[model samples]
Target: MVNESSVLFEKQGHIGILTLNRPPANAYHLEMLNCFNTSLRQAINDPEINAIIVDSSSEKFFCAGADIKVFEANTTEENAKMISQARENMALIENCEKVVIAVINGHCLGGGLEIALACDIRFAAKHQYLIGLPEINLGLIPGNGGSQRLTRLIGVSNAIQMLSTGDSISAQEAYRMGLINQLFDSEELMPAAVALASKLGQGPALAIAATKKAVYGGALLPMAEALELEKRLVDTLYDTQDGQEGFRAFVEKRPAQFTGK
Candidate 1:
């Protein structure tokens, strides 16, 4: 395990696990945010690690959002800088070649929900945990990517309702709204996430990365442009070793041993 201030990094097989380690609430402070981004870059650079899971060590709260005290003390300019930094980190997660999953073990609110939204997939605990963007309660709006990402994930009506009221939703409600990919009992959450990540890690890496790029990049374009983007990505994958290996394995009636080449 690698410890850096409030974040803990660990590798299990081909999956890199990042735990938000600040006790109780696991609120994001400037130092913790910096450590999170640095650790994420390290994980991304490690070729052996093909997938990542972001979770919290705290049992009661995945993350309570930013440290309230810090926000209260900072000037508008300072807060803007901090928000920009946070959004940059979120973009790193969104654009990662390998799949990144947010394993929400407990309460996920405000910036916490923003972080989860940035991930490619999210799995939450099924124990009635609260998850939402409650910045309105503080007489502020979501400073991170919450406004945009939330609307994209769920619909505008749902996003607006949640944001306007500052009301948190249950884990099941989040799943129903497509905010989270799946829900599991508290004890089963990490294991389930690891199992899913391990399967993806062992699959064709190049194809997986291309698919992610195609889906995310194409989502913002018109239908015709999106189809063209998909075609380009599919054509580009034909030159990859893993692509050939997958075809050969299918013909040979054997499991492909993907080396991520």
Candidate 2:
């Protein structure tokens, strides 16, 4: 049985764990989407949090996708409101100050895959899980940045094939396609996620943020402009305490204790 709440949050060290708790398949409705945004905002706003992990309470479904019933019961405009919320949340995850990782231990489809795609890192269990964007079957396209992000992450040709066919791929196949960063056994999934978060937490927050900003922000710019942006970021980091500490630590052959300053 699942909890009544659609989203549950837990804080572990510098990591905030957001667990999807909807029954059946953790599909998103208005209530669930609101809860998710709330929980995620709480984590993002917490100064103590250095990283976040999105997981599911269900053993069989990371998320099946948006609840079709919500759309069925609403007018087209009403449905647009919900999709807008999802779009905002996806942007939130993509641009969060802290790193976000999606730990997928079960089926990840449609909006579910879009959610993972928005995350900075995705680690799925190397078991029976499948991942895909099957919105074509529902007479729709991916509405939550899936089409653009997927194309950017993988490539246009692969993204076109997947979006057009509405086909799902196994975890291994998804990994090969660069959909997920890593794969592990079901039992080791959470531990692996925690480990990665812990590792990132000890690094310089400002540098990490700048790197992410430069990479994502640069991707859309021309080569000349992107190089200038990268140079500007590097110059800014060189003036920070953490940056100095990193240089000193290297000289002294010691680990740098970053204060995220």
Please list the C-alpha lDDT of all candidates, in the order they appear. Answer: 0.91, 0.91
Per-residue lDDT of 1-261 in model 2, one digit per residue for the tens?
A: 223389999988889899999978999987888889999998899888899999999999999889988889989998888999999899999998889999999999999889999999999999987799999998989999999999998899999999999999999998998988999988999999999999998889999899888989999999999999999999999879999999999999999999899
Model 1: per-residue Cα lDDT over 1-261, one tens digit each: 999979999988899999999987998878888999989998999999999999999989999989889877989887777787789889999998999999998899999989999999999988977999999998988988898999999999999999999999999999999999998988999999999999999988888898889999999999999999999989988868888898999999999989888
Per-candidate RMSD, Å: 1.0, 1.8
For residue 131, what is the lDDT in candidate 2? 90
- Candidate 2's displacement at residue 130, Å, is 1.8
lDDT for model 1 comes to 0.91
Clash counts per candidate, in order, are: 0, 0
Per-candidate TM equals 0.97, 0.97
